[model samples]
Target: MALPAPNPRAMLADRGYDSDGFRQDLLIHGILPVIPSRKGRSVPQSLNQKAV
Candidate 1:
């Protein structure tokens, strides 16, 4: 599989990819993850639409 760009600005994903692990991975890679939070989450996550 092709690797991602050297330095991605951010990552956009659906609720399926909404998880702390995944978000942490993105941060570790220096990329911001813009994914909607799943239902029933203890703390709902807010999305910054302007950044997207």
Candidate 2:
């Protein structure tokens, strides 16, 4: 059987989802991915730059 489509608010993630591509996809799908970015890497500008 095919997997069910994720809820719009559901968090979709994987280890690599820390990258920009995944984050953009989440936004496009109207989902909120709570995936924390990998350590030592700079946080995404669109997400954290304004907080600085």
lDDT by residue for model 1 (1-52), tens: 9897787888888899989998998889888888889996899787756555
lDDT of each: 0.83, 0.60
Off by over 4 Å in 1: 1-4
Regions of model 2 farther than 4 Å from truth:
1-6, 12-14, 44-52
Which clashing pairs does model 2 show?
none
Q: RMSD to native for every prediction? A: 2.4, 6.5
lDDT for each residue of candidate 2 in 1-52, tens digit (9 for 90 to 100): 9686656565645456687787778779876666656765675432332221
Score residue 26 of candidate 2 by CA lDDT.
72
The 10-residue segment of model 2 with minimum total lDDT is 43-52
- Top candidate on lDDT is 1
Between which residue pairs do clashes occur in model 1?
none
Best by TM-score: 1
